[model samples]
Target: MRGGPPQAEQPDDGEGQAVLGTGPSSLYAHIVNKDDIDGLLIGRLCAQIVLPEPDPDAWQDQIRDVCAQLRDQYLKYPGVFRAALAMMPTNLDTLRVNEGLLAILLSGGIAPRTAAWAIDTLSLYVGAYALERSLLVQRQRREGDDWVLSRDDLVGRFEALPSDRFPQIRQHAGELTAGSGHDRFDFALGLIIGNLAHA
Candidate 1:
């Protein structure tokens, strides 16, 4: 689950295979290609995300719980989202998660088309968030700096913007970055769920 482009480690054949503790031939024999490996990893991660039983009264809340669990799993496997982002998860584990989400939306009276599309949007939204966060943490570690200080500096820069040119940025800099990742995630999740219900 290396971040960014999936490149061969040393520009040599079987380097990645070695990393997986297998010979080049054996690795290729089992896994068809990099995409296969991505599927396997995605399946494993999907397994960790538990989906609650469908509940008409609490469907929205149950969906939110699943999202939070997924976020936690992705964080635990830093960079996994980047690697598996493009993979189509047809595996049972991944499908089960999708099924659970769809069931919840259906139970909440969301239209079929909207619920289907919402699955993709919600999945991508959470995956992208996890990927960005993991990459930022990795970069901070490599640079040996405090993320808190960096975030503060960024906020300060925003506040220092010329009020005449960037009034909104200058005025709401604190509110712009006030919440934790979970808070922001929850806000967006609630919005999506609310829209589904209203639609």
Candidate 2:
């Protein structure tokens, strides 16, 4: 939970403070505790990801573990999501995460397509971290939350509640769960891919 060399703990203050411009030495004066995940595990996991031959079958599994690791790291006080941000200060452009790294990840039995997803889509920048957080948040909610109502169904459920003690909760509950995953992803992907046709 402690004892590592301190990392510069700053958020996305890319305003006057550009990572390409200023050193992290004087961004601000705050420090985040390094209750981050084991660097070794993260390295190994990254090694396991980015494989050229990632198996689609095992992709979900690898995704699960990676998301779990992210969640575990998130369990720390403050925010563990910033872990990836902290790791980005090095020579990221020349970072050589070759297929060999991907191959090693596939050796762990990850699916080829999933491995490619990890390598191509997920590993490009902090994009993979977003995917990881998405999975982690969904799993955390799925495990602990019992809310079966989507937004469309929430209005009815809220009105069905016993008392007005939950006024604020009752007020904005429907806006929470609006669309299905399939609809959301399809619509977004459609816009992206469809826009390409126009461009």
Task: Choose the strongest candidate by lDDT.
Answer: 1
lDDT of 1 by residue, 78-187 (tens): 76666556877787888989999999989888889999998888899889989878877777777555553555787899999988999998888888878875788899
- Residue clash pairs of candidate 2: 48-105, 50-102, 51-102, 54-111, 54-112, 55-110, 55-111, 55-112, 56-111, 56-112
lDDT of 1 at 181: 54
Q: Give the alpha-carbon lDDT of every model.
A: 0.76, 0.42
Per-residue error at 36 for model 2, in Å?
A: 9.7
For each candidate, give its TM-score against the true structure: 0.83, 0.29
Q: What's the alpha carbon RMSD for model 1?
A: 4.8
The C-alpha stretches of model 2 lying farther than 4 A from their native spots are 1-41, 53-81, 89-149, 153-178, 181-199
Give RMSD to native, each candidate.
4.8, 12.8
Candidate 2 — what's its lDDT? 0.42
